[model samples]
Target: MPTTTGMKGGGYYDANSREQRSASQIFLPWLEAAIADLPEPPPHQQSWNLLDIGSSEGANAIYTTERLITALRENSDLPIWALFDDLPTNDFNQMFLNLFPTGKSVIPANDVYTAAIGGSAFGRLVPPASLHVATTFNAIGFFETRPIAVLPGFILPMRPNPQAPREGVQVSEDELIPFQKQAHQDLCHFYRARAAELAPGGKLLVQIFGRNETHSTGHGICDVLSDALLDFVEADMLPRFFYENFIFPASYRNTAELIAPIESERELASAFRIEQVEARDVPVPFNDAFTANEDRAAWAKSYTGFLRAFTEPVLAAALPDGLPQENTIEKIYHRIDRLLQDYPDRYEFHFISIATLLTRL
Candidate 1:
């Protein structure tokens, strides 16, 4: 199957992924350090450029861009240009509104310039050798291909049980080998493009859903979502064709694999130095206020809502063409909620976050 970074409509991301604020903050220190370490450009050069990859619905954009502008101003008098990049179907209007929600710019208008760039990170999005800094957070998980058309019993490529495929999940190395190569290729493509787009001494900061080990990287969150989606099949809410062609549109890179491209690809190794690469395990909100009030139904509903906002578009797109009742989207989520309520303790997640800092050589 061809690849796609699943399209998201207005507000789907911000409303669901509450962790974006915290995740986006990870960019600040890296951005500031990169700016501080930047080589003195030609005396005549008085402007700098920054690119934000996969800026969904602008939640993280607001925090990161604000800090970015502030950081840029402290180091240089040069005006900074910020470019926000994502899929064409992403919410650009909401991003601008987020940056200037009160009809007033968050930073001095004369100090920094900002614009939205709509495109995939798999290929080039900016002018060659012109950028001074680039950042990507929680977005690289969305790969540009569907390596596995459908995992019969589950969706997560991050296996909790690595040695054996989960029940109902049909796959083989014959299928996974090529898919793994493709994911690595996609990552290499992203970095090579950055290497070309970044000026000498520039830096690229990346944070994506990934792991530090080759073992099963699966988390409770993945299980919850898979159970929810599979619950629909059990309830007969969705037909079999939906599952036959369905698969999650993400690729979670492993720890060593995160920077393998930079090491193996001569061009990448020549162009950038891996300043630091570390993985952190973050917790997911499970039986919080949503589950403590003794309202299991309410908790399930709320949890399902959270997942639905970010995933509904992709789920709906998987429906068989011309099928009716496909628009009963809430029913699917209801099924998910029902499943979650039945297994609240199992509805957790441990995010293995890979943070990497790269300096252009």
Candidate 2:
């Protein structure tokens, strides 16, 4: 598999999973915060017209829409209209079916439509200055690799070296920095395009896993994997295999790192202003049964499954050769299982969710 420098694949959440649901739980409170900040609807407009960009499976969209409906109904205002949009590949129809089955009122008046779009296709689907609010939950950070879409640069130093196999193709630290920078730049393009699509008064709310400045010490299991891979590359031992088998398939940024490109892009333009930026720690409580049973097998399975599904494929594709299709996945699974047994504490993952409300200037 040849690695692509740009956004190459959809993440795991694209398919519904329990971990995805768990991760999304963090956004419930954030959604409430965003709705509370919304300006009062105009006197004549019957309801708010909302656009949910990158609405994967429409979970967040449905949840937010329902909440807005409750708020509006309490005020005796008309119902709200919501448009759920995503890549054409997303199952918007199914999402609608699931959320609106038999008129549950997840969407008041149920005026929902699906707008399928590409990275460059947003302008065509949304009318200029038409939406009251636009939200993108855990999406919109991905950007295409083309030069026109390149984001600004940033340095992500590799973790300290680990033991190496000691032969074959070597990796250079200098090269990885550029790769990391390009990744950041690409993400900026996606966010800027999203910002451009919003109406003047319309707000764009984005939620994504971000790097925590306080916690990013390259010590977590994810960090250890990165370190081990970089060491393999530097040692020139199975570098190609490492890239093909691991990095490309499972790479991701911490909250701070993910936010850098967006903030950089904002600084370069005055067209959109960020209204709020915040981060909070989310801890998942695991009972004694969760830890004691199956040698943490269930926990490991759930954690790695989510990581592999959402984070791996893209990174795998981005590598020089990408993940091998043969028995490689099975091997990788076993390798992760072993690692989990060795490092149970590292498996206690801490995620940073960043919420930004951007208004068109």
**What total of clashing residue pairs does each candidate reach?**
2, 21
Query: Over the stretch 1-361, how does candidate 1's per-residue lDDT look in tens digits?
Result: 2344343557666776655455446546766766787875666656788899988787766667668767777767787788888888777788888778898876564667778888889789988888888899888777677764445545655444433324575555454565577679889989988998998999898888776564222454556656665656667766665665666666777757889999999999899899888777644443355545777777666566666765677777665665445555666666677767787656644466777899999
Pairs that collide in candidate 1 are: 3-145, 153-168
The number of the candidate with the highest TM-score is 1
lDDT of 2 by residue, 1-361 (tens): 1222222123334342443334445655554555555666566665577776666565545666566456445544545566776665555555666566795644544444433333232234465555667666655434333222211111123332233122432345654665566557655655566555555556666665544555422224354344344444555533444343443211245655545655565452465666666665544333233655645776666555645554444544434544334444344555665566566665456555556666666
How do the predictions measure up, each by TM-score?
0.87, 0.66
Cα lDDT, model 2, residue 123: 33
Off by over 4 Å in 2: 1-47, 72-76, 91-97, 100-125, 146-184, 216-269, 285-295, 315-327, 346-348
Global local distance difference test of model 1: 0.70
